[model samples]
Target: MPRWRSRTRAERRLAAEQQGHRGEALAGLLLQMKFYRLRARRFKTPVGEIDLIAEKRGAIIFVEVKSRGHQGSEAEALGAVNSARIVRAAQYWLARHPAESGKDMRFDVIFLAPGRWPRHLINAFSAS
Candidate 1:
């Protein structure tokens, strides 16, 4: 059996969390390379949590990062995102930061998979 198959549930959960952190870090680096300034990581509100918040050219972006171990799981990763929860979190974030209220807001997704370049989807979803 694979080593992962031998691990306990908590161990697997921890591993998954670490993988998610790495994915978010990679996504952050990609954003910075594209000249986006990172405003927050793992921003948590009463409603939900946003993985990353970046700003550029007067646009405030809320990003969700999804990492998968398998090559063909990227689409499944994207499909697993809770868009409504993310939207609610963004609303809470905006309410807390009134300064960002006037700027254009967008939702983006970064999908990461082993052996594949990170796929960035701009305006991937909407608050509407």
Candidate 2:
């Protein structure tokens, strides 16, 4: 039985938001475990938003997180990511932190579905 089936539309939206926050927290932990230093969460710019920003080995990663109630949708999550928007946001972020400008940067996506292991796709897209 899907819990959402019992929720009203507003309740469902709230639940989804809460779930997304949980997913982002979990994703951050996972990235830390992988030796990525967390930089920011829910980073926003006039151009767009990035769910998480992390760095490892001179590479800055701009991540988009997608949470679902269903499993095995990592590939589908990729489809939900707006690479161009993220790139623009990353550019804005770097502009604010000039010291990071010379470092390598890439966009990534993290998929989190209940009761399933999170999937992280590194260097998922390029700024070009």
Candidate 3:
């Protein structure tokens, strides 16, 4: 009988999307606080989309942001990420920005859950 229980499928989907956007914003802010310059928020390529792109000390970082409703679901949220798709997207991004090709690049993930600080996993995955 909760209000959320009454939400239609579309409503739930919209709410999820909103939550995802908020998570990405929070993640970007976290990166900035750590001296990382944000290059893009949502970088979409023909292959896929990267939630965030950042740079620090001449290193390019491709980040995937994942959010969940409760604490202790970090692993579950991380499991949802498709590293291969993100890697392909990063490749496409690099093709357009040839300047970044020679820079040291890595993949990262920022996990978010209610009542917890953002968890930043650096070098969380690799393109190889």
C-alpha lDDT score of every prediction, in listed order: 0.94, 0.89, 0.92
What local lDDT does model 1 show for residue 44? 91
Residue-by-residue lDDT tens digits, candidate 3, 104-127: 999999988888888999999889
What are the per-residue Cα lDDT tens digits for candidate 2 across 1-128? Answer: 65555768999899988888898999999999999999999997999988999999999999988888888557777887888898889999999999999998988888888787788887888899
Stretches > 4 Å off in candidate 3: 1-5
**Per-candidate clashes, comma-separated:** 0, 0, 0
Give the poorly placed runs of model 1, Cα more than 4 Å off: 1-5
For each candidate, what TM-score against the reference?
0.93, 0.88, 0.93
Tell me the TM-score of model 2.
0.88
**Residue 3 accuracy (lDDT) in model 2:** 57
Better of 2 and 3 by lDDT: 3
lDDT score of residue 28 within candidate 1: 100
Ranking by TM-score: 1, 3, 2
**Residue 65 local lDDT, model 3:** 91
Q: Mark the regions of model 2 whose C-alpha exceeds 4 Å error after superposition.
A: 1-8
How many clashing residue pairs are found in candidate 2?
Answer: 0
CA displacement after TM-score superposition, residue 105 of candidate 3 (Å): 0.4
Best by lDDT: 1
